[model samples]
Target: MSELRKKWITAPLLKLIKKVLPPISETEREAMEAGEVWWDAQLLSGKPDWDQLLSMGPPQLSEEEQAFLDGPVEELCRMVDDWKISFEDRDISPEIWEFLKKERFFGIIIPKEYGGLGFSPTAHGEIVTKVSTRSTCVGVTVMVPNSLGPGELLMAHGTDEQKQYYLPRLADGREIPCFGLTSPEAGSDAAAMVDRGVVCYGDYKGEKTLGMRVDWHKRYITLGPVATVLGLAFKLYDPDHLLGDKEALGITVALVPTDTEGVTIGQRHLPAMQAFQNGPNWGVDVFIPMEWIIGGRENVGRGWYMLMSALAAGRGISLPSLSTGGAKMAARTTGAYARIREQFGIPIGKFEGVQRRLAEIASVAYVLDSAHKTTTRALDAGHKPAVVTAIMKAHATHGLRQAINDAMDIHAGKGIMDGPLNYLGNVYRAVPVAITVEGANILTRSLMIFGQGAIRCHPYLFEEMLAAENPDTKEGVEALDKLLPKHMLFQVKTFIRGVFHGWTGGLFANSPRGVGYAAKYYRQMDRYSAVLTLVTEISLLSLGGGLKRKEQISGRLGDVLSQLYLLSCTLKRFKDDGSPREDRPLLEFAMRAGLHNIEVSLMEVFQNFPRRFLGQLMHFLAMPWGHSIRTASDRQSHACAELLMEPSETRDRLTRGVFLGNPGDGVDLVEQAFNKVCATESLRDKLKKGGIRAFNREAIDAGLERELISGEEAAELREAAEAVNMAIQVDHFDHLGTRES
Candidate 1:
């Protein structure tokens, strides 16, 4: 056996493998090594253990966290005016800022031992969602400190003294913080940064001190204008070899006080007119003590890993929460408008075209909420999940953008006009901001999602790369001999499973015993998983190093993986929310859409593949019986739309956590009209039965006199009709843009 392995596997296999191995750059290698994998790795394994997914605890807030959201978060929302903040003020009020600091809103993730709220990851996401629903500007302000800013970095890698001193200050808002990582030349590529810091000796308060002379120019910083401290990233160099014999150090992080000499701040940039305190800042020959390094002097040249680790919080929690909030708000308000506003003597929502858009909005809301909840729950379970975080950031923002566009189409003139009553206009404007931040959607979808994930989540690819790169040829060959056989077996098994599942329509795929409504979805996802695994291996073998440059193929693969994850989240949400019969329409819509996307994305990849035979082979294995899944049916869409157009527990749960102010407000008016319309459904049917189609006040009075309806019922119907009319009216502003001055 050993002799057969030596000739057939060891020498020949190693030579071929080395020739096919892709070259990984320094930055790419660092990124692949940054965060640990979790459930994403399970899906890549082609046989996810359903028991593990079921074992994860559902996300829940503690009493203290719940109270904080109920009390202070609610108060903050009431204090905010989105129209005023976006247009007139361009920033939150002084009182709101003071309230946030006092309530520890900026320190939701900080531990209580410091001066913060110590909320769990789920609570933190909840706070962001609720606040963002009320005011995007204030939400950005609050989320920055709690997310990728100094507080998070400090908690992850700061020295003990740095934590003790800085955490309390950051928690109490004595020192507002911002992080600077994106230089002009390095928006998506941090390794291309030109910002620099040179190690040198400098005079401190009294004596000579060791520090770096740093110079940096960074833009798009969220809280740059008002930050008291800056978390800066710059390439480091030691020309004199001050700390080490090596001249160049990699990226390094430092904590520089904004008040220090040669530090710049106090300007703002209006991002998509959603105006938070975002701006650019500059540092010219700034001197800092060595202790100011985030993890101290010994931790120099490790800035990229630190930033990558800290990014999981913002990417996975804050932005996704904000997107979810916007989607839910759109679903609620658009549904209300569609029900009350009539055209051609009937509610527009009854029209098929309008129903399609409304259904899309509701399904997007449902899916975004589910993904947000599931990802945050994973974070609370102590998993960083870098690839999952990237997926969440890209897909949630994209979903929000889609939902907002559909909502605008449904709202028509009401959506076009901008005023205090325009609840959706600001969110629509903020869509680009969400898509552009954390990571640009284009770069993330094309490169980061699949490029990083393919190696990080794959079972044997990373090991093979390490083995191929080993310096000793004999050692590398031996390692590949062992790995090659196992890898080939895995590929063959996945291919067979893919072909069998595709032919049988996933009838034989595994499902959890008590999944109930979710059983079919589980089996479908398993079939897709096997297909994805088989295609991934074939593509790697066919494309090798060129796969990195084939971003279009990578992006399509990302879509399939993203849809699988979203579908999984939808199933999890159904079970966790008690699997209500009323919510089945939403579940069906989300699942069907996800499966269709997976099929379409795979087809697109196959069509564009470089290797013709492999592409055709993948197609046959993925869909042996031709296209089996189609988009959601119109019946399913109308059902989802009906849930939104009327008052039901399902609608209430889907739209929960958004701010609904007093009765006169836009959202409140819609809510009131929805309730009134639902209450009078049977009354309208009674009038129709009495042959009184158009029930004007006179007709209602006539019906009352004829005893077709009672006096109280006539009055109730008249009141309901009036409420619907009032709810359909949009606020009109004068040429000066003032509502009623």
Candidate 2:
């Protein structure tokens, strides 16, 4: 333990702070007792360990996996159109549901031995991204089963018998599974849940057996309406001590059959206009045998750990995929729409204002896609990056929010209009649902990412804290003695690196051999990393235990950490994807943007420090280096916009899986129209010079009649007009008729 840890353990200041600060809640207490350190916790120690990350490489997809994505997954996404089902039927059509079940869409993550397709995390992400681009409702339907639900929980913690019974049923979709974790009162603070299960002898199927009588009220459960089995998390109580002496066994997870007596399921919630089976469920006096307990009775009271672990594996995959999908869709569609839609006789994309937004949209899409791919690779490598997942979920959704807003700004009225022809509206409406789920962006940022991460990721911090709280004085001292020397050395190294990098602009930091401008980005990241380490140490030492209560400061620190991780991913992506020259501007923009955000976060940390003198001192230490960081230039923005304006192999690669068009919908009509208009540029210029600008169908016919232009010019002009008309079209639906009268 460093001096900070020593002080945290034995200092009078901590003791004083503990008294004045709010007491730790049950949730916090439970988390401490669980005592598992995650990957993010290690990174928070301020050391950049690139060996594992760099060595992992990009996620690989086998030929069969690729074929599955291109075949059944692609076909399934096309079949469930959000526009048709959202307002009219309010759920996926029966045919689509049956197809998903038969194709085992719900079992992508289960093991092959368990009768499901055992796919890599990368493949799972690809499937969700492709599906999300077409319909969020379908995406949620697919994601819930594969993510933090019973299937995952069972695989990780189920008894052999439980696995033998449940996994196959779940894998085959013979049992539709939904996990009830979030309650009406307990959202983020799940330890505060009121639902309870009591151990006692209860009549089950007319036989007296030792079981738990559970009563639970859960809301916002995905697939609740149609689920046949629900994985329920509740507080388990044993007042009679039927099996153990403990009265309470913390939080416990159990598999509850939805059709059992006293179980009520299927009260639906219409989230925005997008429809999926999301609803509330409750059970009164529901009896389940001890075997139903996940991981058997041995794992009782460990539900929080199980849920967190399950989330660690799957959380980083799903929502980030959805967000990246939205970004790709927005970039692809808005780029084409801006070119095809004309205002003042030129494409709206030509305007500088629109170009700025387009640049942001493209940049966001690129960065988010890069982050998603890189993080998923980490997951596939067997690292459960809990903090990374939290950061990705919060940050990617935020990026998606910005990308969608920019897309809407560029599309103007067309984006706001709700219809099948309007591609951007449904995604925009579903923004809240994405940001609010998994973990709300606010809590994830302010608490989970940095709050838990700072203690968890720091090399000696968790050990030191655990030792301090340990009852045996000799053991605590021995542990601290073991860690203290290394911790002190780490602090010394951090100090030297900070001063050296800060003074010389990272000139001494090792840069990869033969890399070009990206080398400077790597160096800049080094400088920021040094600064981040120094500040994190200073903040923890200065704030002590009270830092947990200071959410604003914690959130800013998280921002700094998250930006660094994202920048790292961006650089890795540039290298992993063959370092294409066309993507240089995007890479530049992403780096500058990340550095600017880090600088801002640093300033915020300094500004919000509880100790004014310490804040000023730290700001002085950060000095000219911190203040000198700049954002991407307008020229870079223009270059990014230009990349989006014209269709190229690069643009196509970036937006490859985005759903542009399918049969029965004119989705690609805009791209087709833009291509046609651009193809006849010579004729268009001649007509414009001849004072025949803004030609509609009638105007083109009139021009032909008067011989203002040749027959060929008129014919091409008519084609452009018709294509534009179809491209700008929006659907009209009868809202009242589609609803209950």
Candidate 3:
């Protein structure tokens, strides 16, 4: 059986785990049942509901949709591989777009009856990601229309006539569509839009015009200048109350012909160094006929709601696809580089230091690759996941960026310079695009995945936070408001547990790994979470969303969450192919490195945290096997292990003080060990002492030089030269100090 299969079937461990933990209170249980933790808490906090989007209507498609997805995916993969290089330097043209239109690339998500590919989310995701591998510009172009533009909106809310008229033409690329949602004043704050669609229902004219009035100015729109159609959004104003009773009830979605009388296409903006053919589009005072109202005249003032649903689906389509492509480039370059580049007559890959980096890069690349594929499969499974999509967008992009950076480093000078040969160094320069695009990292980092997903991922924080604050939840809270009181009670019990566990050396108390090596990090994470929960509740009481709120729990919690998620991703990738001899190093190294990073991160959080703990707090909160520590110990046991594998006595860095070097030829024993020692902190530090420095060179010439020359004459040799020789000889150390005496 596959390693992943074994891990996949680990149900019994999880069940055993739940039985030992404290049972969630009834109030908190509601949060658990709801599958959200943070946002619900926000609602309970009485924060204004700023979200303009609606119930993301079911994202997963039906079997028919699934059937539609397959063919497009395969074709897209082919196109990507074929156009790989042109994509690197952002090489493409109008001819390419025209060819894409001719090949029906523009219509994958349109309904079949509409003359498009009629593919499902999964299928669309597949095509988009595959193309993104070769060129993300292509992927974005493929994603925009099918996902958030005229095609999705019309399919969801357009009138029968609207779909019949525009769908077929859109599928055939006869009318490319761009959705205008973002503007300078309105980004995350969509309700703040100043642009309005005013009504001019009745005029003293012998003419007939039936629908609601429309006017808009939009920028940063994809497919803007080139599109034959536009889906515009504006605030609904009812002077005659055409859109229900409320003056401005909802944002509205309107289909506007590109050639409308008041509409004017403006200059394009290309920000990402992508193909200019498919970048940003702009327009001013776009006006369309009354029949252009999506879902006819009935759905006015509901544009925000409509756009949200589409954006959610659209995000799942594009960003993840781009990240996947970047990952592929990272793996391709690193693996290719490892196979070639030689130093000291051996491939640099032969060195353990270089090999470790290569392994990590491989591990990350594969993990991201698998995530992209799996997320696509889930999309194919007929379900759209808002949080999952967000997570993918955040994590996958990060992985690609890190992997590419590592790839660039591995290439060193070769990567930094522009070369005649086609390579990933250029791709490395483009790393910021993915990170900055769709959403900025700080926003995504601070608010989106964790800030938003905390609601989805937490077990009790959601409901309890709400119940504690609201009178409406009085009955529910009354039954289980044991929240604050329970936390106090739990801490006492926790102290009791901690005392017993620590007294017993914390062997096999909680967590997955038992005592011997696993008692350091993972268990500490558990401890940290338990402590943070009590503090979080306290903050929820004292400050709601005030100053003390952020301090209740640090971003470290989210960071841990992020690490676990990524490590899980890495492990899954490490296990994808199958267990084999060649894979052992990669798998073990990835797991060990992941565990070490998490543990260290946890330790750092502990150190800088305002809360004080015994300095050895890390010791009590050990890992499953102290994996990093244990790996170092094990490597030490193996004589064949690299000199760089040992931990530094001073500080830690990725390279472990071992220079990324190739040992030169003709090295002697003392020279070799001495050279390695100089590379190491311990020996390096030792050489700095008074006694050591005093004898350093002169003594080396008197005592050591004779060994290199003749036993009798060496004593008469110089001492100053010995120290220099000793320093230089470390790489070839054995050649000196051991000569005939």
Candidate 4:
């Protein structure tokens, strides 16, 4: 075993890393210590068991779930459209709120026996995606209660009595719940919160009993203003020795009624253009029974763990769903607008520059939607997948941000305007909110994904560390004696796998049976997976505990892992959807993009590695194929862009359920007009020959009225003209009260 350790080149480098790198912070250490190994942990370990992943299947929605979506959810969406919820300062209308409460929109995740809808994660994701296409404000309203609130926490860690009392109320809308976790001073570092609760004797139902006096200041609590109940997390103190001799029992979670004395509520916060009911709530020495603690006395000092677990479950569903909605909307609307809104007498979609953006929008929509479905399906299969969820939350939102920006660029001036007809404006403004919430994208990428993932996901690393740290020397040596040989053999296997995959370009890789064209992508994924495993092992061995402080290295490693997962999902989506030939361009584009990103991340890791010699050797071993990996070609981009140039069954199928807004809205109207004017070659030729260059209503009408064109083309020309006119128009607003005066 000692000889095996000596043979590893990174052994001495580990000691060197410990001497040079800063010590790991307590928060970082805690995060690493939290959560058990999940599926992502296994995949990143270089064991690409394709059969097991494929067996999970696509996300399934039951008949009842479909009926609910087509019925009540659909009806609610129509109501939002009719109400024009996007323009309202109050966010959702009272009538719409009542409709949502009556339909039990807030109860999607609660169990049926608890008087709730008991919907699966797939159903939950579908509902959020469909609703988000209509109004972001309304989407946030529906999303908040179902994710990271009392309902989710209660279901996971609540006492039976608490569940019975609170679950039904939450499900039926008798209680609107909001979680008070993020303080103004402690947004991401929740452990730094100053909210405190002291155990003492207090009056409960007119009887003297042991209770807690809690004081809290929390901000950015979604649903805060209207919440009937607050789920509070605060540090608990037992200075009087009321609960044993401990002075502090760490952070604890408790339920507090909003109507309690000295509690302030209903302070609204307007987030950018969004009017969601977000604000601050504070309490001054409010008393609560000991029973209010999430899991009663037995679960004290476990609030952080419970919260992390709840986040693990819900984060994979809500934000990803909303991001999927944004991508789908961008794809559908931008594609149609590009085809219809012509410039230089030709559709802008035909231009190489615009085509590049269009292709990106379409491809982003495909990849993100695939990721959302695959992750939700995994959740439904009963895997919490903490690291996977963090990656999805960060990457999906980032994808949405890029897709919407591309859509805005395609729309040019029209996308920036705010109005009833401007569909992309609201979504554009909502991008920052998604990027900031659910553990902010920056932190998730730089710290959590690879930081926690490296330790939690590795098969033998954590065990080996535990054994090395054991107090009994003989036992510690025995454990290492058993683990070191297997670890050495595993490293050898991974190196060989990497060599085989690199040499063959993944041709001989072990992948599940699939279409012949997709096989190479699977093999490439396998090769990268092996490379990631080797790099991670080398990183752990070279940096030891100090790797936790090397966030740049950790973040790059996360990028490789995340890209692998995204690529895997892309392949799964292609195969699961029947491997259509028309969609091959998109699949190819995603594969190239993912592989290129993996290569870039690996290079960054090697460039920044502390030990130069080991880094160079490892890079050589990993990239035996060559250092430079190829990206998607312009030809591939053009092919994907061509698919989005016109309204086709494939386009509609790809962006299936996005609400394209009303008839006069830019998206739907432009699509209709483009299809109409291009129906006949004579119409196109006459317009081209007549030299009607501009894309306005008058030029199209003038071209049709000329003797060069016939009467049958007149109606199509007029409708196309009107649609173009509406597409370029923006809403007008008066300055303050000047117009009234």
Candidate 5:
């Protein structure tokens, strides 16, 4: 591989991340000052609550907690699972939506006063998980209105009258609200939206331009076909030179009854979120009173800000909860099926390869769950975490995609087919869209997180800085960019300093696992924080002339930014939880897997750009995976070994992954274990139908208990894995503080 290519594939910078992680306090405010990771508010200071496990106490299974957790998640699982039923029957039952709404699913996000559940983010997540487990379509419909629709807007900015008039009806489904934002020319670029309005001033001066004459077309509107009221976003222009009314402002949100005069919502257009009611709603020259503005007349021309604040919380809730639940459901179903489905006289679950993935799927499920909860709590705390939400959306979705995929791998031929056996396939098809929506993961990371952070999270002079950059003075505009770098660099240096002060501050950081998770935390923050800054500057410059171009840049930024946010959240949880593995099992697992994934996806995205820029694509494609990235290879291998211990015939199913997997690891271990088990036909045949329990029973019969791992074996495993990992690190040139190759 080329030197740059090596850097892209390996993870050398992991060292730096490890160094910086311990100092991160319970508050992420420190990251803002040191990382220049700011926006919207003053940067916070202090350390993270790294000793979370201690604070949380042990992972004891309370009877109530266990019961709640173990309850028929099947009801929830069927939501996404039935897609297989649909493809097999080529249709779905109406019971899907009915089953959800009747369960009070529709009311989860609405406040209790509004005749709804008035649930918190976690509650909403649980409901979505249930919906997505059986059907992502159901998840989509259930999530849209309650989480991101009119209810969110009204709560945030609506006038008392508006909330009182609309929220209750919406909660009961007596009136369904649809948000009209994206237009034909705008997909990810909402600010460049083409819809606009001219104020309708009366000939009388007292009522100058209190209403607007609007024209616009919007597509990809969920519930558009069935909406009773439309929350429309359009630019407000001073038509007839009317300036007194709020309608004279530039951009505004208006709630229009679909039946109002001069208003018409068009036909339903096919959209990829095709499972439920989805369509495009268009309008031209629609007349709407200025009172229709969300949050009332006081906040006109501020639609973007209003919408964005609500979306941050909504995004965190939707994809993370839905995706995590879906993945867990898929894994649960697939694992059970693999255990029961026999081949070569043994069940598939006995295979080491399958075991490895199961472990990973389980690990991911928990991590995603924890991370989802963290973000939800943040929302409940009223954090309004813009950057954090993006991260949750991207990271959770990415992990879910993998968890579902791992299930498919174990399912093999059964998974590949479009039948009840291949239940995981339908949700898998939607992987890309999940990542692309809500500003796309790219923009969430690369632009919005850091760009917004630089302005929002700075210490001391954040407000002055924002004012400096956005000053009305021409000189201020010209000099602000230059002033920004000095302050930004100072923050970056603080981050470096804080990293060194870690663990020295406490016993937790010194613990091996705490160290690992902390390392991952800082490494990720450092790796992307700078690149995000660069992308932000460039995007801002690009937008000076071509305002819309920033949207595309924003999308790219979102992807990188989203990854960073999720990774940080994962690290925070891992460190705080105090897992006991040598490398801090949970922490290490999250890191190795997260790093490997982020790197690969980053590479794919980076390489997707013009190939001609390979030599010096500094401003273009950035490196993804590098040697600094950590590896959970040791754990993965151990788990895989357990999975491969099935019968010989079941071993055949693993043939595909072995060829596709890394060449260095002893790929034959799984197959070899299978053959050894299958040598005795009688034993293999007996275990085929229920190999997992049977094999596990046999292990008990064999008396292989209390394996603390001999020092010799531990040394050998470490030697082998460490060597392999070292090679990867060197090959990827990860030592350099670079994000993209």
Candidate 6:
């Protein structure tokens, strides 16, 4: 230890820091301590190692995973009639339920030894996404058990006995599992839950043994009504100090069998009328053995950490996959409808307004799908990536909302009038459910993403916090002495990079070779990353603890970080796919949109910085040339929109993994019309050149009579016209909109 340096610098600096450090609540500290940071740390570094991202090989599905997706997944999608599930039946048919059990759909994330499919996270995500396009109810059914449910928890932190017992049951659907975390009074603030387990002797299975008397009421629990076993979170108290010196054991998670006495489980809440099994359950005095505690009694008071870690990987998969499903469904169906349905004697897709909407739909699908694939691969590679997972949950669900809104706007009448043929109707109603669950978008954006990200991703900030908090005064001061200089150097370098990159538009920024069309995007991302790092440091320095209360500022910062990650994923997707020529429009749209969003977010943060002059200065440093970037351009939008309308390889690749259903369904009809339209595009163009603008029986017959088209070509044109007519026709009900009622 350098005694002279410590006496001169560290002693006084530590005293000032202690005076300034905010009082961190137990909950906040536990949250800050949970989950590992990965690529997010690089983006926050301002000098991301481009090679690190490139070194992550392309995402791929194993042969077993691919076979499952092709086999049971596809068959399951075929069996779900979304309209009937949501409206008439209000549940998947009993047959489908049995099919889920037999196929181990609920056990996708469990290992093979546990009798699960033992699929990779990517496979799990792909299955959920593919099924979601068919039915949200079934998707939720599959997603819950695999995600933050008991299955995931048990696998991660279960006792050996708990794993051996519950994992196999959960895998084969012998036990339908749901985790009860959210209570009426403690929704987002789960740590504030009043659910309690009092330590005491209790009777169990004809033997008196050590256990706890638990009482809890939990709501908004997915799979609750139908679950055979339940995972519970509650505060444990040892008023008698039976098993601990402290009365409070913090939050603990335990497994409770639904058949246990005093347990209630047979009810359901209609979530947006989506027909998923979610509702409240209560236990007046449920007694569970000490061994029932997840990871056993030694792991008490660690429930919050366990839940946070589970959510880190789970959030990256389930909701984002579902969100991407909604987006791809919207893109495929809306594009087909826009192409086949005529307005003013031309495909409505030709309208610029519609094209704009279509562009958003397709691009949102593209970006969200890319992120879903990329993030799931990270999970598969054993990276939890908490901050990035939160970003995925927030942005992907928001993207779903945006894409569905555009689809509804385009399908105005069809979307508004919900019926059997309204493919977008059920998904539209389910948007709010996705946005509200996992974590509400408002809270996730305004707080968690950047609020948690800043300390977790920063190289020295968390260490600095720990150093400041160390109980030994001399040790704390010494730690700070070593860290402070490095921290200051990092801030200086970040500021320089921000200014330099902004002035030059990131010309010499590090980027991989063969990025081709994405080289400029990579450079801009690098610039924005530096700008974000610089502004984040300045904001912290200026606002201090008060920045936590300034959610608007934090949210804008979170937006900047999220856009950088999404943009990186988009570029990675392009490179992984060998930068296909056919997919360039989708890639370009995604990159342009992501970079534009980054610019807007950075500008917003700078403009809203607490110090007005400082804000202005940072703004100029971020964009010295008066706003060099704009939203995705109209030409890009046109190209992306046109890509959606036609039956192109790019469109297929973008919209793949969605359910096409039977041959006569609404989506099926749309598909038929789209293909027929493309097939007859040249034939119709030939007729157009012969002065037939609109396809009609009369026009086709006249063309054949005039010999401008062959008889076979005339038949093809007539068939195309009929297909379009059938596709654009809205369903009319017999009575009350159901056939069997």
Candidate with top lDDT is 6
How do all models score by TM-score? Answer: 0.96, 0.94, 0.63, 0.93, 0.66, 0.97
> Which 10 consecutive positions of candidate 6 have the poorest summed lDDT?
732-741
TM-score, model 6 to reference: 0.97
Q: Model 2: residues >4 Å from true position, as ranges? A: 1-47, 664-666, 689-692, 698-714, 733-741
Better of 1 and 4 by TM-score: 1
lDDT of 6 at 54: 78
Ranking of candidates on lDDT, top first: 6, 1, 2, 4, 5, 3
Which candidate order results from sorting by TM-score in descending order?
6, 1, 2, 4, 5, 3
Q: What is the lDDT of candidate 6?
A: 0.88
Between candidates 3 and 5, which one is better according to lDDT?
A: 5
Q: Candidate 6: lDDT of 323?
A: 94
The deviation in Å at residue 342 for candidate 4 is 1.1
Give per-residue CA lDDT, model 2, range 21-126, as digits (tens).
Answer: 3355556645543324443443455556554456667778989789999899988977777777776789889999889988888999999999988999999999
- At residue 196, give the lDDT of candidate 4: 91
Give one digit per residue, the lDDT tens place, for model 6 in 1-741. 489878877877776665665556777778777779999999999999888887787778999999999999999988888888888888889999999999999889999998988988999999999999998889989998888878888999998999999898888889999899999898857668999999999888889889899999999999899888889999999999988699998999999998899998757898887999898999998898999999999888888888998999999999999999999999999999999888766899999899999998998998999899899989989999999999999999999999999999998897887666789988988899999999999999999999889878999987877787863488788789889999999999999998899888888776778788778878888888888898888887777777888899999899989988988888888888888887887877777777777777777777777888988988787678766776777887898899989887888888999999777888888899888988998888888888878778998998888888999999999998999877776766676555532
lDDT of 5 by residue, 506-557 (tens): 1222222335436635544444444443333433333332322344433454
**What CA root-mean-square deviation does each model show from the true structure?**
2.0, 3.3, 16.1, 3.5, 15.3, 1.7
| Residue ranges of candidate 1 with Cα displaced over 4 Å | 1-12, 471-475, 689-710
State which candidate, 1 or 3, has the greater TM-score: 1
Better of 1 and 2 by lDDT: 1
User: Candidate 2's C-alpha lDDT?
Assistant: 0.81
Candidates 3 and 4, the one with greater TM-score? 4
Q: Model 4: how far is 175 from its true place, Å?
A: 0.6
Off by over 4 Å in 6: 739-741
